[model samples]
Target: MNHMKRVLFALPLLVMASSAFAAGLAVTNNSGLPIDELFASPAGKGAFGANLMEGIKEGALDDGKTATISELASGTYDLKISAPDEGVLCTIKDVKVDGAALTLTAEQGKACK
Candidate 1:
């Protein structure tokens, strides 16, 4: 009975900890251009992973529009935004993401190319 009680007591904490591990990012395009691609990488990794915008049904994320990237683990990340045929428009670094939806605007980016 004591073991069962202990297990039940820890169950909710386990659930909360698991939920806290999942994170998401909400990006708003404000760079005065349509964003054709967006990528997120663990901070300081140098190489970016997948294009987060690939799943969007409306094509490019137009200026002033927002998109959410889900299923990411909570951590620091770097964001790369690009325009169609324009190469990299900007890269935003050191974005801290927790379980809450973190918001980013294009104006926060640097190193346009």
Candidate 2:
């Protein structure tokens, strides 16, 4: 019975700790172009993760608009923004995300080859 109580007490702490490591990112498109796709990966990782724009209802984030990406963990990341027929617009490197939410602007992206 004592062990069961201890386990129950620890369960909520575990849940809170797990949640603290994962967070949502709010990206604002202020680059003067529509963003058709968005991808994020851990910093220094060669490959980008799945397209984050697929979760948006409009299928894209237009200039001056904001969208929330809910699948990120608290850490540094690289962001890739692309447009249909325009290829990759830019890539933003070393973006730090922490806690429950972090906001970023697309205008910070740099030209990529």
Candidate 3:
């Protein structure tokens, strides 16, 4: 290959390499309550969104609340709800997000117990 041809070929490859990146998830809460905490990692992401009117704390999560999570990776996650200031409550539920939306509702009695 000529010098000019080589340079042109290499330029495209470099651009492609930089643009390639891993996937990511977006966490949103519209349950009319404040989510305690959200857990996300390179492996995947877990979300806990819910309404606090039903015995749930406003702008906070008490014992149990409404929650919904999505965009979880293809693995296992120890998911729980927290107050973000007072730590966690209820129990740590073992959740699985297989590269799709995993809708979850905060529960008191879980299988982990």
Clashes of each: 0, 0, 2
Candidate number of the best TM-score = 2
TM-score per model over all chains = 0.61, 0.62, 0.34
User: Candidate 3 — which residues are off by over 4 angstroms?
Assistant: 1-23, 26-33, 40-72, 84-88, 106-113
Between the candidate structures 1 and 3, which one is better when assessed by lDDT? 1
Candidate 2, residues 1-61: lDDT per residue as tens digits?
A: 9999999999999999887555456667776667888788888895897887676777787
Per-residue lDDT tens digits for candidate 3, residues 1-113, read: 69999999899998877644323333333323244655433323445433222332344433434333333556666555444344334334465556544444434223223
Query: For each candidate, what is the lDDT?
Result: 0.71, 0.71, 0.43
lDDT of 2 at 37: 82
| Backbone clashes in model 3 | 2
Model 1 over residues 58-110: C-alpha lDDT tens digits? Answer: 78877778776555667898877788665656777897877455555545633
Model 2 C-alpha lDDT versus the unseen true structure: 0.71
In Å, residue 11's CA in model 3 sits off its true spot by 13
Model with the higher lDDT, candidate 2 or 3: 2
